[model samples]
Target: MTGELREAAEPTRSEGATYYGRPVIKEPVWKVPDVPAYLYLGGMAGAAALMAAGAGLTGRPGLARAGRVSSGIGATASVAFLVHDLGRPLRFLNMLRVFKPTSPLSVGSWVLAPFSALAGAGAVSAATGLLPRLGWLSSSAAAVLAPAMTTYTAVLLADTAVPAWHEPYRELPFVFAGSAVASAAGLGVVAAPAAQAGPARRMAVAGSALEVAATRRMQRRAGMVGEVFGQGRAGRLLRTAEALVVAGSVTALLARRSRIAAVASGLCLTGAGLATRFGIFEAGHASARDPRYTVEPQRLRSR
Candidate 1:
């Protein structure tokens, strides 16, 4: 352990002690709003693309159209946020030069580029009523790529040195997948007609359940690093997300029968997704900013 935090940590080493009023590690340089927004939109768009593809193949044209449009917009916006974080569009393109399966950043860039193009093209064709076969094919391809898009962010975060993020790698992917599904479903419920929204409402309920379960399990398994999730700003946002999930899940059950219910459920689930992304981001930062979380977890693992 570093000298500055050694004394502070000694008194309560089991609990990771404290920061001793000084940061023990170099904080992440990722920007606010940009990174968090990218995370949120990437998940939403990925799941939306998957749902859209399924709808298209299953004869649910309205739902498919809505999903394609939402995915296209969300994916395009997600790329913008990611590019903004990189500080240059060319920097993002540079990452595409090598297909490094082991590098999350490189892999993510590759997955993102084609997924965005196909999803966007699918949306365009759906909207203009041109090339229906090609649009369906494009959406199907995007769907194949969507699972990676939704869960890859979790993998990316887990690869980081952040205590909270890296320690909970196994659970994070599940949480991300569920959140993505819920967000995509929320969009469908909001945009699709009631007759065409049945699948969406069901998806929302299922996804919300998975997200809530995986998140709770992750917290319990996170050990002391998990404490950050329930403290300060992170706590508030996560609690709010949980509340919203519960409310939204219940509301979704009533959605197919009532437009008002559908709208409310959609907003709540989407809002929960946004809040979860920000909250998880904050928790990772908090864990890194305080050295105890990092040092202690490593200490225990080394033993």
Candidate 2:
């Protein structure tokens, strides 16, 4: 990301605070679809790698193969979105020059770079039935990196000045992890046969539960700043996401019995994941633009 920010309006004084309607911090200049899509896809890919690894261990070759393919595609698309947002592919490469543990972006770049390559290599080999050793190695490596890939974005976002993201840092990762799990399970359910889909259906339920719990906790803990997630565009998207999660989890029970139900459940889960990412993205930006979110939190802590 450019990290460039939009200028806020001039401050107007009121009640000993820069009150009324104005931003206290600069809003992100990140464009639409690019950043949000990147987050969603990256998380999904990360979680998919884990599922792929699990399936491999349990002798479910079909699910394992499908997960590898799904992970590869998601990772590839994620890189594309990141590059598009950066406005140049070379910028991403530059980030790999050094590993900065303190900087989520830097570490994320390194993680994504290797993870994508390995996942892609694994997917190709698994699909084409070539380079079996290379496929096993790369896929195994990717799974090791998947947890980081899935959650570093939450850290990156919370590290920012945006109150909606920063104040809820403690809970954001759980929400994101759950979102990723659900999305990965969605893919598994859609791609694997009914007999091989039991694990995926269980993941859908587990992920949905975790996501809902974390989201609720985050919002409640955030106090006033949390309002951004419950109002305007963010609210609409989040509500939709939660609804989809409910529908998908419920539908997944019937998925093993019917292909149509599996497709429907998968769609709902994926939609929920997409909507959750975008909704969180929107909430962060909205919080950044509002002075109250930045000011009120500090004010409360001082008391």
TM-score for each model: 0.93, 0.94
Which ranges of candidate 1 are over 4 A from the true structure? Answer: 1-21
TM-score (C-alpha) between model 2 and the true structure: 0.94
The candidate scoring highest on TM-score is 2
Once fitted onto the true fold, the runs of candidate 2 whose alpha carbons sit more than 4 angstroms away are 1-15
Task: Give the alpha carbon lDDT tens digit for every residue of 1-303 in model 2.
Answer: 233432234344552364656688998888789999999999999999999999999988888988899899999999999999999999988999899888988888988999999999999988999998899889999999999999988898989898999999999999999999999998899898889878889998999999999999999998988899999999999999999998988888899998888999999999999999999999999888878888888988999
| Residue-by-residue lDDT tens digits, candidate 1, 1-303 | 888788765765444445454667777799989998999998999999988978877888899999999888888999999999989999998998899888998898899999999989988988899998998888889999999999999999999888889988999999999999998999899899888888888889899999999999999999989999899899899999988978888998898898899999999999999999999999999898888887778778889
Per-candidate Cα lDDT values, in order, are 0.89, 0.91
Report backbone clashes per prediction.
0, 0
lDDT, residue 163, model 1: 88
Give the clashing pairs for model 1.
none
